[model samples]
Target: MPLADAKQSDAPAKRERAHAGAVRVVAPARLHLGFLDLNGDLRRMFGSIGLAVDVPRTELVLKRSQTFKGEGPDHARALATLRKLADAYKLPAGYEVKVTSAIPAHAGLGSGTQMALAAGAALMTLEGIDHIPSRLGEMVNRGARSAIGMAAFEQGGFIVDGGRGELDRAPPILVRADFPPAWRALLVMDASTAGVHGEDETNAFAALPPLPADAAAHICRLVLMQLAPGLMEEDIAAFGDALTEIQKIVGNHFAGAQGGSPWTSPGVGRVVGALRAAGGVGIGQSSWGPTGFAFAPSQEIARRLYDSAIEVARREGLEILIAEGRNRGASVEKIANT
Candidate 1:
């Protein structure tokens, strides 16, 4: 359907004009640093920390319609997300949604949650409705397990979330800060492999033993005492060291579910080790597996790490990407209908 002409008036017209056409949103991809606790005394579980990155973002273009129509490589998932929002909010069934740029799915890059939030935000914008991240996340059934993705989508940077207990709301953000601009993250991915997900993911969690009390306490200490302070002081080496330690702890905790190795893919450990040997620091896997990341304090060092690891990654059929930390969140815009 053709977009309704914006009414001519003063205040109301200005508001209408702002949302009279199509709504477009670009949501960032996030790297899951590690979970703080799986077993907690307060009934909370899986508190998490992560950082958003500018590349591999999910981009969507949406407009009101007489019937729901979805287009693009990720159209199926986008349509499902839109339907959930529509049903929950009693919104119209009609919408034309298009996924322009797609994030890599199931690579531990927060693709699913970002896409869902992007679609929901676009629909809300098309309707000229204002919303906070948690509400938008709820409308799309995201932030159920971890709030890091939702918070990153709302406002990029490093985010730490309190664990989810009995609360139906999105996990509260305990900390949020802009990651240092001089540091870069080197992402290594095995495109041929998929991480644990869906029913498999559910079963994996169920079969795993609870996190040990001691490990949880240690992780908390690293995050609070080392990682947080390092960021505050802009000390890359300190932050990187703490992050590496946290990754090792978390990786070992989940090793039972991810085979005998701490990393999901066999080559990940080798790649990480090589990066570290070449001066990269703060190395770890993102989420379930197959995507690994390391930090460098400067672009030159990042490039050096990538160059050194590319040969090893190629031997394992993996691809490497260099991304800087994103200090700002997603962007949404209204495009005038021609």
Candidate 2:
């Protein structure tokens, strides 16, 4: 469903009015549009901008219980997250958690962070505990790096986080604005290839050279001058150009870690090239991705790009999805237990 239709169909106020036993929360997937500065002179690191997408989200249902139990995909991770949250908050010992729908893990789509927050939010709501995302994130051992996922979960849209410096808090949101309604993003992923994660991800960062000063300067300028302004004015072409430029700089910065090409998957470079050739714009990868995205000015254009790229993606065994930008954050509802 489109975001507006989804909102109307699952209105939280209406659902809450009929509350009985369970709390359900839906959190969007995020596209990490490269970090602002991986090598800042100050303690600040990984300032980021990202867009939240409606489909392929993390959905959870939770209810208070005597002993913690988890069901559905990634059940073990969900249970562990809940236990950590309970331990950190000194909350009650039990909650029954179910992951009804889960974002694909380690796809560079911010799945882990969103799942943690969804689990935290549902548990807190069921227990009648008041909590904000930052505290919830800290309890769940997230937001240690970038705040874009946490902030996007709380209030979706195109988000920019100022980065964590010396503070232990969530990175402050430097800006938040609704992505243009007419613009659509095509998310393409190679399911056969898993993105870098766990110890490997940590080591990749440790191994990466500091981002060149000139490149960092260029990124900062692009975001501040072109990207931010283009979004504000709903200028799709300008925004697309700025995004492409940023991706080129950041992609090259990590080329060594991801083999000679900036992309993690073998054919992703060709796919991106084909999409651009087909008139898709704003091409880029999300985080440590095998998943990549590009933008279109309208639904028709998005579909055309998707149709054109479907063959290329199929040849490479990629999964392609055309999704609209999620202007609002997550939706939490209280559902009656049957």
Candidate 3:
């Protein structure tokens, strides 16, 4: 096979191994749209819906090294993830995992989950172990609340997970649908702030009251009737409308955790507000977000909206990028002998 470089990893790659060679895994960044049913009235909680985007991805390489080390953004976390995978699978510890690029950490872009999965999958390839993305996710303690990251890692698209139940490791994919190729997701990012995380996140959940069953039911109806069908039919109005409403409901419920606001970063919230008036739709914050997103029907419209919101984004010290929906999942490929 030809030598694998950065370009080769861009294509859809299959998992493979070569003697003493390097393996690269590209994990996509995902947007956690909203939770469907957080109340657990149906004996399930945190059923979520999300979409995978093409830009802002995590890419990494793994090869046998005399010493165990990792390089690049979140490399420290990557090393820890590797250790977890090694212990769980009984694999050797001698490996160098280089993270070439990664999504912004704690930006509500699923960076942590993507990093864990990419690191684990790279190690799995090098060791010739079983290749299961969800298993890798479980090994790294991902998918505790939403399995959207795991699902996006394995199969990028619009994903809906059945939520956590009796199962321990993986959540069932309730719906997986392709997003319109022409549609765009404009990301509103803030580098200065971080969303609620770790112990704080846990505490926030504990402090919050349980969601009302009727509210959960409303969200379910929105997803099942509007979002899903709108996506399938490529009706941005219907889909974006549903998504916007869902975000409102989920945001209001979590507002107490976010200082009585739907957004974690007020700057991001401001920019998203401007973008909304600029013709962007499906506006919402991702996860416990300092990062927010809005959708447009086409790149042209997205760019136009982006331009219109540039001044507002600049004032808020935020960044904006246009991204298409990713229909394909993460890829793993082996490079020639290192």
lDDT against the true structure, per candidate, is: 0.83, 0.82, 0.86
Error of 2 at 94 (Å): 2.4
Model 2, position 245, has a per-residue lDDT of 94
lDDT at residue 177 of model 2 (Cα atoms): 92
Model 3 C-alpha lDDT per residue in residues 68-112, reported as the tens digit of each score: 897898898888887765555545346788888999998999999
Estimate, for each residue in 1-338, the C-alpha lDDT of model 2 and write its tens digit: 12233223223333343235888989999999988887877668779989999877998898767899988987677778778766655563477888888999889998898988888787667655566887677766677778899888988999988887897777889989999898899998887777788888889888888887778888888999999899889888889999999999888888888877789997776787789999998998998898998999999999999999899999988878988889887888777763
Candidate 1 residue-wise lDDT, 234-324, digit = tens: 8988999999999998888889888867788878778888999999889999989778899998889899889999999899888889998
Q: For each candidate, what TM-score against the reference?
A: 0.92, 0.91, 0.93
Which prediction has the highest TM-score against the true structure? 3
Q: Given candidate 1, what's the lDDT at residue 189?
A: 84
lDDT-based ranking: 3, 1, 2
Candidate 1, residue 313: lDDT: 89
Best by lDDT: 3
Misplaced by over 4 Å in model 3 are: 1-18
